[model samples]
Target chain A: MTILLHQNLERAAQALPEQTAFVCGRDRLTWRQLDEQSTAFAVALQHAGVTPGDHVAICADLSLPAVIAIYGCLKAGAVYVPVDHSSSDQRLCALIEECDATVLVITALSLNTRHTLETHAPSLRLVVSGENQPEQRSRLEVVCFSGFLAASGRDPFVRPATTPRQPAYVIFTSGSTGRPKGIVHTHQSAGQYAELTATAYRLSSADMVAGVCPLHFDMSTFALFASVHAAARTVLIPAPVLRFPASFALQLEQHRVSVLYCVPYLLIQLLERGVLDQRLLDSLRWIVFAGETFPLRSLQDLRSRLCHVAFSNAYGPAETNVCCVRHFVPWQECAEPDRSEIPIGRPWGDGLCRVVDADDVVVEPGEAGELLVSSGTVMSHYLGHSADDQPTFCFCPATGRRFYRTGDVVRQNADGELVFVGRQDRQVKVRGHRVELDAVENAMTRFPGVLEASVSCVPADGSQQLHAVYTSVDRQALDAPLQRWLQSELPRWAVPSVIQRVPTFARTTSGKIDHRRQGQQMAAELTTHNKKES
Target chain B: MIDQSSFSRTEATRQILQFLHEELLNGSGPVTLQADTDLLASGTVDSLGVMRLVAFLEAAFAVTIAHEDVTMENFLNASAIAALICERQEGAL
Candidate 1:
């Protein structure tokens, strides 16, 4: 018997119907309400012509309705693609078109982008507003969410027969190419990840997990699926509260959140500005950080302050959801301020990993090379791309397993733990979000009058920031418009912070753009400028 | 005196709204922001935008905003920001 993601919800509903399942701001949903509402939503989607395996793109923030919509899509046997609600219209339209999404579960707050969606997403036939009733005037059929559910009647929805091998969801991430690549995960893969994570964290019904990451981010799967697997409560932190660390701490304390899975940058913010001394977050049992390396000094400070919590450094690309995790109790390990890197640890639960050279040959035990992951949690394939794509995956003949090529370069230490070295590509993590420099340059070149664009990563204030130098005919006139255009094209973290117009880019002997030289120059100039200002 | 303070707050609110619209938002945001709009809740301003807004207010109003004072209550909206600025100015005087 195969178990699907929504089956966890059903089991929990039967076992703990009155227990709170999800909480977002002032809204709360018990297991029974969540189950019934999601069932109603499933019926609504079916009535609205959403067939099994159809793509239903959810464009809403972390809210109760969005949670309901996710479960609803799963119950209806439709693939739920979570889109960043704050993304620009052009990006949203591109995703909707790429997935050929027939239905969109959107919040009222994002209705402003409807016009663009109507024009661009031709396959989008139905729009279900999560909030207020929209006055529909578009070619696409729009319905109020509440009304849609009410109209579906009380008839029990027949669960669609779905295999574990069927695609459960598609998450889009920054690609080396100009466009975003959608990573598709089957129900088996995602369900295996949820079970592994729940077992690793020792989650139970008494635990309250903090849903910190946005739905679009891959890390959000842990909070969303793992909690359901354990029948635990999930407190979806609102975006606004996240901006103020003090407020975020209040939310954690108020909810007595037991487990938090977020990026290191957010945890750093909580340490610096969260007023942790005032809040008694004694309920917090585990703090898992991933997506980027945590600065050792800050990690020490955070550990010192929150002495009771166990810290884990989780590592995996979006292709493989948390294949490796290093767990450490602060007091157990020696605090070495000089240590710069933390080990990403061994593969989790039957997962296989190996470091391979450029020729796909396995490297020596201590040698640094690109890491490959073969795990049940691994994504099936990137949407619209062949599974045999060399850059994405490599076949291990020795083990007869397909492994994801995690562009990350790592070395195995004496303890058989993987230590991060550097990237084998131009991909960099900016505030825990992946940004491909090539993609940023491509977006800049899309602007009118821009001839060429070169983006460089500059270390600023303990984190990496992107700086771009573009060649344009009209440098002075193109500044504001180019900035606006880039804002509309890329995610906020991917957009370059400092953009300068240059006559020409420095080139290497091979005629390619010299990014290393440009990055060094920009860093030097910024340092001098800061010094002069001070 | 009360009228003068209220007038100054209104003026400050206008200037802040203009700055948010032109600088932070870049006129591409989903909703048009009013003085009383919940900038945080509405997603009009993000974490980076909040930092930039604080810097802009410090320079524009000639008031220093302490790190501890950068709470949601003091920066929830244009009106709230103006009130924080006014209070800081009064304290300085």
Candidate 2:
């Protein structure tokens, strides 16, 4: 029984040992090599005092070694926590401390942050460097990855017995409370997600999947777990290559990538700037977009261009790993001309979905309500929260199941497909990553000079961008320092693009800052400014 | 015709590095960037940074960089960017 996530890697290695499993730039790891290295690394982790249920943080870019470290953590029965290596030192330290990670697998790019981690994360004892052995200066024991793996014998490490309910991994997402919340997924939940994704896409060993999203993003699960489940080759697109659309498209063509699961933002970039007319991308068979809504016009344009490729819209929050998917039939889309937004489709596999009103009563067909999902793919719970403390899940009396509140308002169309209306909360998707407006506002207020902050999401270039209007005494002097502070506190996607200093904010009748009016005024000003520039 | 004598390769490379350090990086980039520094692989430049660099290059060097020209070959390093600028200027002339 392949209950654990790493079992897929072992099975793939046994079936297709010599096949290329992962490719990143010039580095490629065969299935056998990946399996063997991961097994050895698992033993190494055990020797380094990593016990079952311990959190192992991996602060590295998506590379062959990082992938191996992830599987190694899983094999060792330790929950793997992937941290964005590009994030500021402060954010990295906060995540490390929050997760109470005992061991850190870091790459050379982020090696300098070890000093900060040593001071901030007291639970961290061992540091496994992906590069050459750095001189140990801190209390944490540092070991080179190559040396550590070599010390462990060439034999496979004996697997530890673990229940399906045990935590497999923890993915941190933007929390409305200003702290990034860790969403804990059990072995059963993650494994089910991998199995469902492979089955849904009909992924095979012949398919070359493009791993475009970073490891920290939930969308990366499609590239990591799904590809492993089907024994498919995953080409990890480098961060730099992802920046240039032409280069990104070239990678797709060069690798003959058949399946690509990414956000709408990247697809829009490829359509506008990728110069796809010059490249032959017939190898692309399926393109699945999730995390945010794709603009219909851009989607239509892309469909027109890649007539052979199938497009799917996947829907689910991080709490539920892609419970629903809509595969667009080219003819059907053409038949329905008036359809403005793509439906999120029906629940897949054993997943159950309910749309309910404020009273928790199920809404009638075609009525808009908050989406509730119950499935094997649903996460166990947040890391710091107990089952009782979590307000995200509610019990459904009819199904006798706990359903996760998605906070997304959706309405059922005539075809029985759920169409996304809008977010019921202050959370918005920026470049497909969730950003809570309240969180950004809170971070801005943390700055010494800022008195009040209000953040708004504005649609720009097919994706959403954050804009902040704040009241500060030192308006001119605060701009650079405030930006620097926010960049250090939050992820790049969460940072506001425009920060305007306002004398006073528009207030509601209750004396609370009216965010809607402020947002409208900003949007109006932006539109007028853009028109004048053009 | 553009005056080729006004700008040398070294001067162009210096200006590219300066722009990268001041504008794209916002003083958060590496302390020193060599001519052969691998910008893309090192995570020195991101996607949005590349767009800004392209615009800066076009406006500063008086060269129009096509969309297809923004590949790793030309933008991989300061030297490569300078070379692309010189090539564009020569092509225009």
Candidate 3:
């Protein structure tokens, strides 16, 4: 019972050596091929001086090489930190520095990124995984994918000494105080969640899983690890295709994908577009949605359309990959009447869920309170956090177990299922990515001439849209320059839809930024502006 | 080809640029949306941003972009996006 994540890949390769392991676009790799290539890549990483406990940054899209790089980094006993390949070079460089990455595994698609990193983090070793090789650059050691594989030779398997307690990965998420918080997870903890996911989804070797989420997202763990654990074939849908439901549905049909893991926003987009039809999704058996709350109407519409497919709504913070899962039973089967909202379900695996009051006392069942999760899957700590900022986990003297405050509002129903209320903090999900409204505002204030700023997620055309309102001394500075600056500082999704300039931001009685009242004022302003144009 | 003249590259670029400036770029930056502005490579619009842009184009141009049409090569920049719209409009007409 080895808990190392790569051991599953090794066993799967040994058992089903010729089985199709991964399909990225037109490229397909067998279990043995993936194992051999990753082993070779791991050997190359060691030869290139990546030691155990070293951080390897993987900044690439959903490609075959990206998958191999993840496994290779794990096999090499290094932490695999995935950053979005589409991020600005500045953002990518920030993450690379924040994670203290010594090696970066990137693809040919991001050649510009390689150059940027070379200029910024000059000491980094770059391994290019694509068709064409990049030209030699000064102060940087570059290795071509084909050449590295060839040079490493066959069966040069070098498995560095690793322990279950060692950090396996570091995923950066939005922080309330402005900076991106890196959540570190140990090998055992991450592997525990992966195994739990595979069993919970009832995945098997015959299942073809469609990974719609990006590697940078926490949900992509199923795409990378659970499939390998189950010896199931994982298919990564391209970023562009994911936008078009008709195209995504066609891919599902063509591949006979059995399990789908994506955010509810995507599902809602597909349903809203009216392109998610039966023929396109005839092969799908399980529809797993997470990262945000699922709208009731969208869920009902999907269940009505795909009656045979099972719908499972998952809930958890990036701290604990996925702690709670609620399977939607049919309306007729439930004892209680159907409600407008969906319950986040009971805790999965060894997770313990509790709703606590302000005094840290557990609330009575059916009462709304802040949810806390106690599990082995909780993140080790926030990267680079001081002793005061660390310890999101609290030890329960009564139970002698650690509990991480989820900061999510939830309540248990009569059936003992935890129903999601709203977020207790200013954090909101923009297309499944966690965003701290204050962080966006912080970035906004940093722009020259900006006096004060606030951001809110407003409902627009049946979708959550980010709207920003700011007061600036220089009215001219409220436009394009501010946006370009925010775009550089934040991810693309964090960029506000409409950035408006105001004389002053409304405040609360306590003189704090009255987010709720400001949101209403901004909504009214937008309506008035719309009316004037019409 | 009958409606190709109906969708001029300059007009298409102007409208798309306006949409990017307002909806995507928030009209606060020094972003110059030229014909060759490399939207995909420069991260001007991400994958999610592209989806919103597609919806905007489909509505503004009255041209239905197929699922296959949402590629980085086809929607890479103002010129490529306008070219896609004109080609689709011509075919539709």
Candidate 4:
């Protein structure tokens, strides 16, 4: 499969010669067309001295040609690093320098961030699309994806040779201090994850997926890579559609999209907008939501709203492409409060899950502990400066095998289902009392029509106080129902002192709920309101 | 837009106040309305504010702030803020 990541297109192009593999805004490309276009781009990249294992940085949003560039690098035996097109210039340049990439492929949308990179990164090479700034283009060797496609690659396809140990792709996730962390993956490891996961989802070429998430996000990797490897068609949703719910749903139906992969926020918005109906989504299957835990109320709203499709929970970090997933079969069955709770479910495809305490001792069943995952899907580690480059091996102490430390706090129920506790750092100590924010969130989600809820502890005057942010299908109308529900079940301290609802929660690149912003908003709102009254 | 008052762009303290008044604009927050004294590191101004202030000075002075301009000398308190803006504006004009 490592060999095929570069060479797989060769066989796929042969087997499905004229079959449509990708559709971009009324333009459909067959396997033959995709293969030819990508090969031509790779040959151009190779000619520009992008040799085997050379890092090729991609600076573009989701598009057919951009997608081709990602795989083309691998095909030409080089690793691809994707930078978020919307990221700040300072942030983008930091990542480019850290990856030490010598070549960059960019689109018109990504050109603004280039003002900081042009004169710097002396070894950087370029391939531009749409329009070129000739003065800027001369700073680096620039060629367009279209221009490259028109160029000749006369020879038949010869797959570039790369060892299993070779670098495949580098995705930069957010750092604690707003810096970027470069997460590197190998073709051998990412391929195993992609293939097994495709089988788990029962994907085939018959499917046409709507690619909503950016390639820069790890959660989007499943859609981007899996569809290519499984020979399914994909359409990049336009930016406007991505921002608004109704437009996004309309685009899916208009494109005849059969698979939907997005964050819970996007899914919740689709349900709120109610653009999807039986006719619109009949062909759609395998709706995977990850990036953050789903509010049970929103999950139920989706089940009741769209009763036909399959909804699945996808859980993982950039370190491992995908670690675990569970099907929300008979999703209506899970609509009941006790039925579909926040169980991240078990590990995916031969992966092992362990709940261990601070002492590294496996906790008794149902006890909360940090989750340690050991799997073939485990990451090698952070690049060059990594103190330990060796992968964290998943081990069963009883059986004596190495394992991966997931750093996730999880507990196994009697049925061996894993329920995510909040992060280890978020555990609350109030008057030396322990509180799980998820527990508070669980109680609040029970409120009728309350789609999502996030709880955080922040200093009010001197000590920490519980604060909750939520959204309802009915806007601020759900406030009364939420207050009624929490009044019955929660203690005074446990109940969020302030429940602020928003149009949407600010999410990080990987899709985790951004509590820091909520906390800031809380402080800002308090000061604003207090001053207004005074 | 800033409500202009009689102040020298060369004075570090006044320039800091101008940068704060421009970037923050007293938008429904008491903290912004309260003090112009300790704007830096008071959580009143953040990393984003620093970036915007740099850009604001570039247009206000018509001068380029180098990548090396991120040091505390140009960024500490309002005095530092005013000093950087004034230095750039004085030379720029």
Candidate 5:
């Protein structure tokens, strides 16, 4: 009796066939329609030679078709890999090759992306989702969405038999080696996460959930799968709409979204832009925040404004599906400004969470150490890489349970709650996207004239920004070319916010790059620049 | 009530092209940017580029472009962005 993820969709369609499932702009779909369309899509994938355990790649903006593609791949028992629509051709090709993807579903809105796929990944089949198909030239066959759907019969297609232990999907994350690492999660892990999330949020079919995250981001699981598990309707907010806080707040009101999962950076932006108001967000009950640490001052402001909404801070890596969660009573937390740190709180379910010192021994209460978490929701392994290559896991002989080293420094408070301190590694969250400072520096060093590059995250206006300090003796005019090179090589988010030219980098007593002092100096310079502008 | 003299398409295009050359692409690059260059289609302007362009427009034109106005249709090129700026300035008038 294995619990499958697609079974959630089947059960919801059986119970509430006419209920609204997903809403993106004016487009809406009922459970019955979603179930049927996904089944038809699965049949179409099968017709296109997508067999069980095949890898299907989806690169599109947040839309109905993208949702359908995700479920269809799952229903067909294939691992779905979602990349951002804005990914460069090189990165996308690398991902396709990395996963050995057989079929790629794209939107006509992205003609450049479609062309790139056709040009680069010739062996892979392309399923165009929108109109305005260009004249085909590649050896691969291209099928328009309407044509592809029409090619398959309307009969309900049964999903292939799969156990919970099988791999469900692979999500790519930033690697320290300047290459993206694919983390594979089993069906049981993802299903348990969705179920646990639904129960934690107390979601019901009556709740309207707001999807504020991109499909490639791990936090989006709550918006998509968790909503399905609870039979709740999810309303996806487009990226452009996210820029306009007023319109986004209006959408929340119009859609009557009761549950929301978002990063603290976005919450701060909405508050700063004056888009968050009591009346506009009156329907919101649960507001979950993750991906990055929320500044205590901003959290206080948000809590004070929206006293009725429950604020929960969740802590986990992409490897672990949200192991710990802390629910905050807005009124209670806002009253005490002395609460400088927000506790990530206790573990969800029976998951084990421990704070260990450098010696791997359990730390004393209130002593900082690396946080280790292990549960049924931990990722299976990194794809194409052996456990020894990048060992984020350890098998403890005493406990007889494998544990993931989260690399996050934390301590248990007096109340037996985990309080996040900082990261022991260079991994930092830039606008909720995981970025490795070393990885950015690695890309920076590849430039023709770069002698040495030191990249670090600096605190700016309550958010983290990557700032680079480089010394290039050969390249006199290095600013613009270096920027262009970085833009072409790395994703936009991974690019540095500000790059400074220096004759030489400061070194510590051990002759290592002094990133700490560099970060401090960069922050000070940015502050002075801000003052001068004012 | 409206002074329409400041909103010139040619002037907007000149400024936008200059900014793109200086900021996004190096001043001297293989890709020749034009007024009608498709920013979204060519992948010249991505999400971060859009944000930087919005900041530039707000500072240069002394106008505010709302988030909804930052779509691909509006920021696809110098011409579209210039048109959006003109429209916003006219609305302000």
Candidate 6:
């Protein structure tokens, strides 16, 4: 009754034997070819000392090689961890060490990355898959992805039957403090998440998903594997697209991609570029976006542009696969609902989300509380941190099942929709005033000329200052009205200490605000100011 | 609102100053900055300040100033940064 994620992928291959499973430019691989490559890569890795339960980290962008390697790692019975090739040299090294990665498969540009990584973690066996290597670098088995399989030319290998409880992948997410946390997930959790997503979005073997999120980011879990599990094809978008949005969408239109998973910020840029053209969206059947929600005007434009396709908002942290979804809510309601707030919506099949108070008591309808999720899709644990209770997986008496505390503040509306307030830690006391930014943003979201807003805290003049980052296309016109609106609605002390404008806010691969990056940016800015003043 | 004519006197420094402000300097200040702003020797920018400023010029102007370009003559003041930006522009063309 229970199936591992790889086994399900194998099943997808069996169902769509000759169908194209993945396509990258002129390079097309049928399901059969994909299965053969996966098996061969699995064997190649085994020969390289990768055993069951080992962590094999693929340090590369989203491409066919990375995708197959993920499959090979799972098929070989090891938990696969992915690092964005674009991750800084420092971060890449930190992740490899943090995950205690065994073997790394990388390309040439990441050669510097691989070198720096090995210098730190010398035990990590490196597999350089690229052009010929120097004589001295023999230990770095330099082989092309195809060459690796070609060398094993139809070599017979058996995939060990992995149980549902076995770990499938280890994904790293930002920590409030030092290094990122590596959250591990088992086959049951990963595959269950894939199934829930496929059912919610109505993805099938006929769908051609435009995979956008980086592999290191958790959003790509559903974008990549969900498509593969459904026997659907994934269009391997190039990595540089993150730096260029217009080009990314052109690739979408060129490929006639049917299913798209994106973040709201990128969607905002796409709208700014007037990318809501009907021609580009004609074949698109669904748009599933995650991270933080964007303005409603965007959803309305997107829906009208692709009037026929479904627009769904996906919600959940990396620690948990997408456990809840609110689909087909109109852009207007979703952007500015009747309650002037939107819920991550009802839990999808087999997923349970409830609002609970401080004492774990379930709140009544329209009451605000902590959101807890109980689902088969919850992560295994933060790898190597088995002793932490905050990360502890437990069963809730209210849900009568194991649930993960989402740490998000929300209130169930009269319509039974859950509207997000913010994170519990996000609440702050500013100058004897308790300011919940979510409340301010929720209020400002109703103000005209207010496209998107995020409130962050800082210490100013011996008191905490609430800073708001706002993004408006017509910044020139928005300046005066926005300042006036904030002055009227917010108390003297509650007003923003600094009102900063970004041409565009940094976004996580999930399209939510890249708060971690913003913090780094804010810190750097503060340091710059302190020096300037001194 | 930058007095473009006022910048003609310290073209090199002004360019570098703007580059630093957009890329290196993070906090808010005069939107229209000037050159000969006593950037480095005057203690306007420090070591990490230099690195941050270099990264900014590279991304904002799409220029690549070499490690050798990180010199007193190129990064000392607005004139220096403008010179650096100019050198990169010439090389790029």
Which candidate gets the maximum TM-score versus the true structure?
A: 2
Task: Specify the poorest-scoring 10-residue window by lDDT in model 3 chain B.
Answer: B1-10
TM-score rank, highest first?
Answer: 2, 1, 6, 4, 5, 3
Candidate 6 stretches greater than 4 Å from native: A109-111, A137-142, A329-339, A387-391, A397-400, A487-494, A506-511, A516-534, B1-93
**CAPRI band of model 1?**
acceptable
Chain A TM-score vs. truth, each candidate: 0.81, 0.80, 0.79, 0.91, 0.80, 0.91
Q: State how far residue A252 of model 6 sits from its true place (Å).
A: 2.1
Task: Compute the lDDT of residue A368 as modeled in candidate 3.
Answer: 78
- Identify the runs in model 1 with alpha carbons over 4 angstroms from their true place: A109-112, A332-338, A386-391, A427-534, B1-8, B26-32, B90-93
- CA shift at B44, candidate 4, in angstroms? 27
Candidate 1 Cα lDDT to native:
0.84
Q: Candidate 2 chain A: minimum summed lDDT over ten consecutive residues — where?
A: A503-512
lDDT of each: 0.84, 0.84, 0.78, 0.69, 0.78, 0.70
Each candidate's TM vs. the true structure? 0.81, 0.83, 0.76, 0.79, 0.77, 0.80
- Distance (Å) between predicted and true CA of A180, model 5? 1.9
Error of 4 at A144 (Å): 2.6
Q: What's the lDDT for residue A303 in model 5?
A: 82
lDDT of 1 by residue, A276-303 (tens): 8889998999999988655555676788
The clash number for model 1 is 0
lDDT of 4 by residue, A70-138 (tens): 767887888888887666677666777888787777766245455567755655666456444444435
| Clash statistics: count for each candidate | 0, 0, 7, 13, 0, 6
Candidate 3 has a TM-score of 0.76
Regions of model 3 farther than 4 Å from truth: A109-116, A127-134, A330-337, A385-391, A427-534, B1-93
Of models 2 and 3, which has the larger DockQ? 2
lDDT of 6 by residue, A1-534 (tens): 557777766887788889988887678788887887788889888777778888887877667777778888888998888887655778766777787777777654345655666577655775646445444453444556667766766567866767888898998876546667788888888888888788777788888898878787888887667887788888877544433345556767778899888777667655654244523566777888887765665566566655677788788877778877877744434443334555678777777787889887889888889898887788877888662346455576554577788888888776676777778877789878877777776555556656677777776567676767776655534655666777887777667766777655655544567665665676568768988998
User: Whose TM-score is higher: candidate 3's or candidate 5's?
Assistant: 5
Ranking by DockQ: 2, 1, 3, 5, 6, 4
